[model samples]
Target: MEAFVQSKREDTAKEPSLFLLPEWMEADKRLTAGFTGRGGGVSAEPWTGLNIGLHVGDDEEAVILNRKRVTEALGWPFEAWTCTEQVHGSRVAQVTLAERGKGRERMDDTIAGCDALMTDVPGVLLTSFYADCVPLYFYAPEAGAVALAHAGWRGTVGGIAARTAEAMASAYGVRPDQILAAIGPSIGDCCYEVDGLVVTEVDRVMDELKLPEGERESCMQRKKNGKASLNLKELNRQIMIKAGILPSRIELTTWCTGCRTDLFYSYRVEGGKTGRMASWIGLQER
Candidate 1:
């Protein structure tokens, strides 16, 4: 019951691979929401194929080309490929038509120090890069609003999920119950282990959520040595539910980027010199 499914590619394409949300597609033809994979790109060596992040040590030209490939495949104008400079904070920027395509090529052009981008404007694609961290998506079709958030450990504890819901409600009058959310591919619990302060922060968030004993243990498992394996996707899902999104309305993906590095770029597996995949959502203008 994974929500993010691999997209069938044309025989000729070599870069810009994608995984799409089929249910979202069926629910609204004008909506496009999904994540990118590691194949079909112009980067060389460590980045291999399709590294869409500009600040991740990949060649700027190569990264731009890879991003263009995704825009082309989605039939969205490259001029609308917008992004932000993610700093793993819970800051959400309200994207306007004027902000469209701000960071498509130059990193400095991106919305500064923002990890989440939300917009009600049609045709403005919202995107954020990720390797192992979680990608949280939000859509309020009633208000024609969509958001994409980058939630690393810092952002997770900072409550980016709840901040996104609040931003949607304040900016677009979107009710949390009316919002549909999707947690995209990231490092799964099996591949993600942390200790010390990381554990402390995660536990703090769990406490805020008041997770039941069984659920709390499922969210974090301790090793004999004191490190803990964390389920980031599940944590974010619970955070969204606490923010008012129904459990049934959130689509969680089981595709762990760390476990399936063949299909994704995992910073953990690649020793921190890896590429980044993108999560994108937009409402195409009719």
Candidate 2:
């Protein structure tokens, strides 16, 4: 079954039209986690609707309003919303109460120099934006912790998934076995083609993981023309498994952002000028 369930609504602008983690993963109601879609917002043109990215050339006011709309739909406080300036690096920042709402309204206010954010502190709704790059989620409910990572090819090769798990274990004593990780919607192997430098980095990651030939072939397939189609979502899943998280504990989404442009924003297909969706995971305060 798909981990991310799309909530149906009549008008996206009037209600929350986003993908949600099913109840099985959030049975306690203590955790609120999911990814946003490209509907139910006020952005125009290439950004279309619900572009929740401040750095994507969308109107700043529209991006802020769209973000507020998302929080409102999630029944989370707008003031609790937090974000980062994703540089596609593997740095993970530990968010605290003081950092809550840091970048809710302006890009300048965003937590700088990080591609990932985690928190054991409740009420800090950790979020990161995405167009085609992968969005990774980590939840250690036992320690009241959760994390969100933006893994482009660079971050993936850098082992951001393992880094995030290590951060949780160090800061909150949350073991990797106890972590529930999820790879959210992004461009699937069916649509993402790469070559040259991109291929070289991926090759290195495969070697580091010591993945078997079969597994490596599935993660990235070489085309007849020498280019390769990369499966970033699967690659991240393997990273989590290698980090000691049980394979059964990780949730992988099959929703390909590139194939579902009507419901998602695809940087490659959308001609580079596109909006961004958001991945959020946080523990609401009791």
TM-score to native of every candidate shown: 0.98, 0.97
Worst 10 residues of 2 by lDDT: 22-31
Please give, for residues 1-286, the per-residue lDDT of candidate 2 as tens digits.
8989999877766664689887534575878889999988899997989899888888998888888888988888899999999998999999988899988898899999999999988788999999999999998878888999999999998999999999999999999999988999999999999999999999998999999999998899998998999999999999999999999999899999999999999999989999999999888778
Give residue 4's lDDT in candidate 2 (0 to 100).
95
> Which segments of model 2 are wrong by more than 4 Å?
none
- Model 1 spans > 4 angstroms off: 12-15
In model 1, state the lDDT of residue 141: 85
For candidate 1, write residues 29-148 as lDDT tens digits: 999999999988999988989898888888899998899899999999999999999988999999998999999989889999889999988999999999999999999988989999
Pairs that clash in candidate 1:
14-40, 15-40, 15-41, 16-40, 41-50
Record all residue pairs in model 2 with backbone atoms less than 3 Å apart, i.e. clashing.
none
